[model samples]
Target: MTSADTWIAAAKARADKRAKEGKVNIGTYTGNVKADDVIFSEVVKPSGHKAYDDAVKTIRSVQQAGFVVPPSAAAAEFTKAWQDAGNRVLLGERKPADAMKQAQQQAQQAIDEATQ
Candidate 1:
């Protein structure tokens, strides 16, 4: 299934399970649903999962630091060119210098095209 479909299915499953349990307490600071059970707070106390907690901490830290950057078309083009060059080098198709020079040229061309 698609990403959105998978997400919806997972969410519906969670909701169904919670409803079956008869205690639904969904936490979300971004939501606007005013309710007695729904917690609208910045800190959604740890879930006890190390990996998930770490990811949440990192996301909250980045959000607090205002480090989130908007997507850039030029950066995407440059990254694709850079990855192609690295792949070519890895496959023994081109020398490192030649691959990098070509990558740079492609990225520069993308920038030029974007500006024009």
Candidate 2:
């Protein structure tokens, strides 16, 4: 019999047996509706369950010079760093590069005053 037919037969058997015994709770006897519940072979396996060998190979390649990280977390870090720098500038913290340029302008102003 097919899976469903097998399940129907099992259910009927459970109900019949329960009725004979006058057992009102038939839920427990209805367990294992599938006739062929053995051998849990994976059809596609769970996603993200990477093999150990595959992980080792990927790690080794990441250490190589010619390795490519396509759309990786490195891109996210770079974007975050750029945003942090812009935020530091906005927070009025003394930015060294900007301070250096301002100092150079002030020195030039002093030099222009001295020359004039």
Candidate 3:
């Protein structure tokens, strides 16, 4: 539901407040929070004509070449990723645990390979 978006945003705000109150690891979507209840966006490969990929290339290159944006260019990078992903975006009901598990698995795989 669209209301979830507002709630999640509020939760984030509260978590930030809690952090200011010396609370760490207590995020709005941390416990019992469903991913489906949060904003969701998936990037799909764009068609040939539209979409700028230089930013993505740059991000990968930055990761590979050890680079960091100087804040001034951060917005541009975010914008590019959004645009290049064919502008296909959705927001709603994203459970925190599922996302975290998938991310952890991917990271674990990468780490396993790196050590091997």
Candidate 4:
């Protein structure tokens, strides 16, 4: 299996475990937490790839910066940032490092703007 597949499997396992424990919403892992939070915390584990790791860290940082619950524009920005990075990487148009760097900057900017 590919690394992404491995990650997905691991996440599914975690989600199932969480569900069994009643920590997750029935039929979904996104329970009381934001989907990104679940993905960052439970889905994206360290895979020994520097770029992937950095991207995960960037995502976590943004999520921690109040991108969770929101009528906040920051949340929208975070979504865009994530989609841009993921799309670039998936399309092989950019290295994960490059994509994630841009995403990090955008997400941070959004947080700053939202807080201001």
Candidate 5:
């Protein structure tokens, strides 16, 4: 379970070594090829694992819906602050508005630091 490019690179490297060893067949995970959908695509409609296939569909749907955001350096800081604030609110230790205001300042600070 890696990206297609990574999987292809690793497979090629292993294939080269196996070819040098005079092996004609790459061993299947299961004893039968029909059971290994990742290797033999004809055995399965898409990815062998249902979870992976579902994830692909979900990602595609999200992309189509324009719910994606570009990666940012301030994201980590904002995530930490937001999670802390959320937890405090859940525990009745802070008001939602106050917690959010503090989290916003922290995220702004992170952005300022990155820009400097």
Candidate 6:
């Protein structure tokens, strides 16, 4: 089978296992993809901008590292930084590079704070 087919098979197997574990299938499964309860609960969409996306990814990584919770001060600050930069870019108030740089700096600050 092709790589794509193999992946789909693996996903199906996982879905079956989850089902056996009493996980409800919240969505239907198509031929190529499965839309189970767990899959449906995840936030998988991109923010359409690299800076915001990277900021979010950084925050998630830090949280996963057990440094902060979703509603923690550090997480809020990092999110605010990215959102501010994204809003500036969207409003044409700043260049994309400038916004990205600001967002990155803010993310770094958050990371430093969490690490310390």
* Poorest stretch of ten by lDDT in candidate 6: 28-37
Off by over 4 Å in 3: 29-116
Give the residue spans of candidate 2 off by over 4 A: 28-116
- 3 or 6, which is superior by TM-score? 6
Per-prediction TM-score: 0.40, 0.22, 0.23, 0.40, 0.41, 0.40
Leading candidate by TM-score:
5
Candidate 3 per-residue C-alpha lDDT over 1-116 given as tens digits, one digit per residue, 9 for 90 to 100: 34555656666566557556854322232222343234111111222322234443344334434534334323454434433333232232334555445545555554555457
CA-lDDT, candidates in order:
0.60, 0.44, 0.41, 0.66, 0.59, 0.60
Pairs with backbone N, CA or C atoms under 3 Å apart (clashes), candidate 4: none
Q: Which residue pairs in candidate 5 have backbone atoms (N, alpha carbon, C) closer than 3 angstroms, thus clashing?
A: none
**What tens digits encode model 6's per-residue C-alpha lDDT throughout 1-116?**
43444545555666576567865332222332333222323423343667755764565445434433356557877888888999999999999999989998988899789879
Q: Candidate 2, residue 12: CA error in Å?
A: 0.3
Give the per-residue lDDT digits (tens) of candidate 1, residues 1-116. Answer: 43443444454556567557864424232212232113323214455667756775565445434432236668788888889999999999999999999999999898888778
What is the per-residue lDDT of model 5 for residues 1-116, given as tens digits with 9 covering 90 to 100? Answer: 44544454455555566667854324223322233334334322343557756764564345434432337777787678888999989999999999999888988898888778
Residue 28 CA displacement from its true place in model 6, Å: 7.7
Q: What TM-score does candidate 4 reach?
A: 0.40
Clashes of each: 0, 0, 12, 0, 0, 0
Off by over 4 Å in 4: 1-72
Q: Over 4 Å off in model 1, which ranges? A: 1-71
Candidate 4 lDDT score relative to the true structure: 0.66
Ranking by lDDT: 4, 1, 6, 5, 2, 3
> Which of candidates 5 and 6 is the stronger one according to TM-score?
5
